[model samples]
Target: MQSISELLKFLTGTVFAAMPRDMLRELVLPHGHVALLSRRRADMIISRVRMVAGLFAVLTPLWIVIDLLVFSWPVTGLLVAGRLVTTVAFGMLAVSFRKSIRMREAYKALAMMFGIPTLFFIYSHPLLSHFDMAGPAAAIAAGYAFLPFVMIAGLAVFPLTATESAVFAMPVLCAEALVALLQLDMLNWSSHLGAFWLLFLIATVAALAGMSQLSFMMSLVRQATHDGLTGCFSRTSGEELLDIQFHIASRSGAPLSVVFLDIDNFKKVNDTYGHDAGDRVLRTMTEKLRSNLRSGDVLLRWGGEEFVILLPNASGATATSAVTRLRDIGLGTRPDGDPVTASFGIAERIADGVTDWHQLVEIADQRMYEAKMAGKNRLVGCADPIQYEAVVNA
Candidate 1:
């Protein structure tokens, strides 16, 4: 029994070790990075979805002219109805789309953009299939059949995960299979199979294209939002994150805390040891702070030698305790072989009764300044700075 268990464990470990984890992640899962779903990415995808929908709204109805010229009045009328309905749906989607759309909402819009054409194809294909194949009508039938391919190809325009691309293409694929089933008496089995094979190949290619776009977007986001040296969020992106978290906390009536931290005598490090050593100190400090933070907490490089830590759902007391623990652990050694230390100030939303995120930051900044003045390497986390100051002076 022991041997069997050991063998199973070894086989499981070998299988996992041999797997291409990065490739699997790209193909099977959405990015776990918060920046990937940031408001910037949401807006970009929403704008693209609107543009494609608007284009389809105009193009879908215009195709009715060809239907009228090629087919009989009865077939043309049925096709025109489907086209009009599809056009209206796309138009409504394009016009009603808001600029502040979220990620999930963007995904729904993408689905609608693909779905309208797919429904039109399902309705119109059977109408065209009843007639004999040849002439302009044969050409028209071919156009309807290509709708699924066109929709799958459209996936390349959006930044989507491979999983999202595959899921979106499923409806179009099913519609094609359904339409083919309906026309089995007209076209041979071999033709349906061949068409399905082509679609599968096209979907695979489209998924790869979408994943490439996603990768490109992620690279851009990382460059824009992260600090190049310390790997923490940049000051600009950090402010945006603060605003987002503040509003979320306000809406839910949850406590939000901000910790303003400045390295004690950081400027002296640069003046004495040079800027490269200072940069190393910043990176090392960031690493230590990150190691002690919860997964949901955010660390931002506020500026040179200054950092901000956003602690969502944490009270003033909780943040104070956390910062104290970090202070006790220390921030590693400096180039001069002295231990690095920092001044910390914490402010909580409910405790401070601040109406906006800026106020919260200002309070934390003031307290941090007070900590600096009260002799370096201290924390001022009290809600009432006046009382804390009196005690410090006393």
Candidate 2:
């Protein structure tokens, strides 16, 4: 019973977490995936959509031919030619997706890809004067009824949300009704109602799939980029951010600085107390440091006891001041209310000689080492009096 309850709880949490909230915003207001979702997640989803749409684009025309030739399905020659043309266009949808597309454009392009095929397959569902094809007609109608499910299967595989799937579904459902009405020379109440219920069911399933995939993607990125213990940016994420900021600063002529901080006697804390206490200290210290930093400034857990700060548009003085503020705050007394201090090293980029961001970090790291050598709880910094003068002289 306990195991069953735990399993049920897990399932419930997953269902809620994976619900696609973005679909609500997107259906009402369309925007690029970058604007709509996290840029990394958007890119991943778009890649998957391109692959699925491409496969569909290639195989759809062939499927149409197979049905006509092997199954001897009744389709007008004119309709066949039109479907071929549509196939060429559909193939382009896949091709278009092969490259990077923003969130908004991808949604739009994929919806069209999902919908246009339904329009092409709209055959008049005429009441047969002869009963011989009744079995075939019923089979076709059932298959047509399942088209929304087919459309939504792509939604499950791709990063498409329920609303986007709905956009594709609306056209197909409408086409199904139009064809049905035209076939019987009257409105088929059963067919219309069936389409409505099926759409609702399809939407629910599609939304669940979309939300689940989104949650999975977000979790993956978070785990990849953040330190698990302190929830600070990992060393890798910090380096990537530094590289990006370096290019931006170089292009925009903005100053950039790095601060390297080492927790004093962190190993002593771990040995004296325990690993758990050390973890508490790290998490608490990171929280305090985060409170002192700006949004654009990133704090990375460089290693076990060292943290690095990347400051875009900041000078060496700014980096020093920031570290001073950290020192002033006392970095939050440890869990036992014992004082804990950290040593700091600072480095800044200059126009005089443009060095790689890594070199700039290494300079700060060396300065941090110098501080440790000089005394455990202190700051060592290297800053030019006229910071950008070297740039001017250069």
Clashing pairs in 2: 18-211, 32-104, 33-103, 33-104, 125-183
**Residue-level lDDT for 201 in candidate 2:** 58
Candidate that scores best on TM-score: 1
Q: Which ten residues in a row have the lowest lDDT in candidate 1?
A: 385-394
What's model 2's lDDT at 318? 78
Expressed as tens digits, the lDDT of each residue in 90-185 for candidate 1 is 999888658664777777788888888888877877777777767878876877777788888888788777688888999999998987776633
Q: Evaluated with lDDT, which candidate comes out highest?
A: 1
Poorly placed runs, candidate 1 (over 4 Å): 1-28, 35-37, 382-394
Cα lDDT of candidate 2 equals: 0.66
Per-candidate clash tally? 0, 5
| lDDT score of residue 15 within candidate 2 | 52
Candidate 1, residue 189: the lDDT equals: 82
